[model samples]
Target: MVDALLDIAGLRAGYESTTVLRDIDLRVEEGQLSVVIGPNGHGKTTLLRAISGLVTSSAGRITFAGQDITRMRPEAISARGLVHIPQGDALFPDMTVLENLTLGAFLRRGGRAERSQQLAVVYDIFPRLAERSSQRARTLSGGERRMLALGRGLMADARMLMIDEPSLGLAPVLVDEVYRQIARIAESGMTILLVEENFSRVRDLADRLTLIENGEVRASGTVQEVLADPAVAATYLGIES
Candidate 1:
């Protein structure tokens, strides 16, 4: 088998006095859609933050595409094509949707032609964003905002995209639309690490599934392998069969 595109081993990170992730090891192959699912406050968000350089790691190593990025600054990491989209739709609400997406290419080394090409790619995946290009981000609907956030990430030309809580706080109908866009992104050849609280929306989308709890990995395997375990099914999934 080939090496994983993103390899994290013994990753431990947290805030001042609170250690959230402990000895976590995860690997994602190129072109795979991997997901980490768990209950709230179990360090799921922190895991993505650490990988994205938002939080510092006290121990362990993170290597992406054979480069050691454990201590690289967030911007430096992003320039190398690893991008993170955190929870809560972190957008410049006052800026026009086009402005926010242009910011995503801040670290990219390219001229207007290249940038426009990337913008076209994002717009193709999310035509709604193209339609609202001149509108302020704050004026978009809940689902549209999420799509804009995703479009901005694409502007970075990311090789690996780590997204936190893509389904949070959306109506069922909107959730379906957002997830469909994510699926389309994956199909376009970007490796994805999707972090979601519940599996109902993303259960069928992951190539590998990992369950995290109390700052540790409780289970990690193919979707069927992990979901078929009785304890995981009963405790988290509430599935009897």
Candidate 2:
């Protein structure tokens, strides 16, 4: 049986006095790529925030690595190897690429050599980052900045990476390139839970697809299963059965 690395049951959260997510149920299995696709403003980002402890859940339970972490502090959650890379490239504008990357390892416990080795691994996955290691993060192009954000997440030595809208605010070409690197990371055995607005981009990469609408799970299964559902096809895919 495949073990669920992250599980959410009936999770509800939102800004103060307003609920955005209601009865959200989802699970990401170990060593698999799970994709959550939905329209904008449908609580996709909010769900990720609740999982990462940036937004607290008002009800339900969140279990990570077999422990209940419904109310864990954000830093405490990060220490458990669950890393969240938000939608935009949240890098340090004045910091160099290398500086931003190293900061992701703050939760990691090790000496210089160990950190260096991990840095090498990330560099191998994203050569462009290595090439621009000395350049200020703000100077890099959109795609390069996304790569840096991902590289920083990997630097955390994350057991599972939660990325929100990686393709957001990028040119078509850059979106493809970013997804290619994401596939490379998944190929290297990184468990990823990715949020995307476009289903076509992730249809081939996702092991499982969960559809969220109005802050609740609308459909979830293997990619084929969800795509084949008549209601989902008609409403989300614009296909009539």
Tens digit of per-residue lDDT, candidate 2, span 72-186: 9999999999999998999999999999999999889888888999999999989999999999999999999999999999999689999999999999999999999999999
Pairs in clash, predicted candidate 1: none
Q: Which lDDT tens digits does candidate 1 get at residues 21-110? A: 999999999999999999999999999999989999999999999999999999888889999999879999999999999998887777
Predicted candidate 1, C-alpha RMSD: 0.9
Best candidate (score: lDDT): 2
Candidate 2 to truth, TM = 0.97
| TM-scores vs. true structure, each candidate | 0.98, 0.97
Where model 2 places Cα greater than 4 Å from the true spot, the runs are 239-241
Candidate 1, residue 87: how far the Cα is off, in Å: 0.4
lDDT of each: 0.92, 0.94
* Candidate 1 wrongly placed segments (more than 4 Å): none
After TM-score superposition, the amount by which residue 68's alpha carbon in candidate 2 deviates from its true location, in angstroms, is 1.1
48 in model 2: Cα distance from truth in Å?
0.3
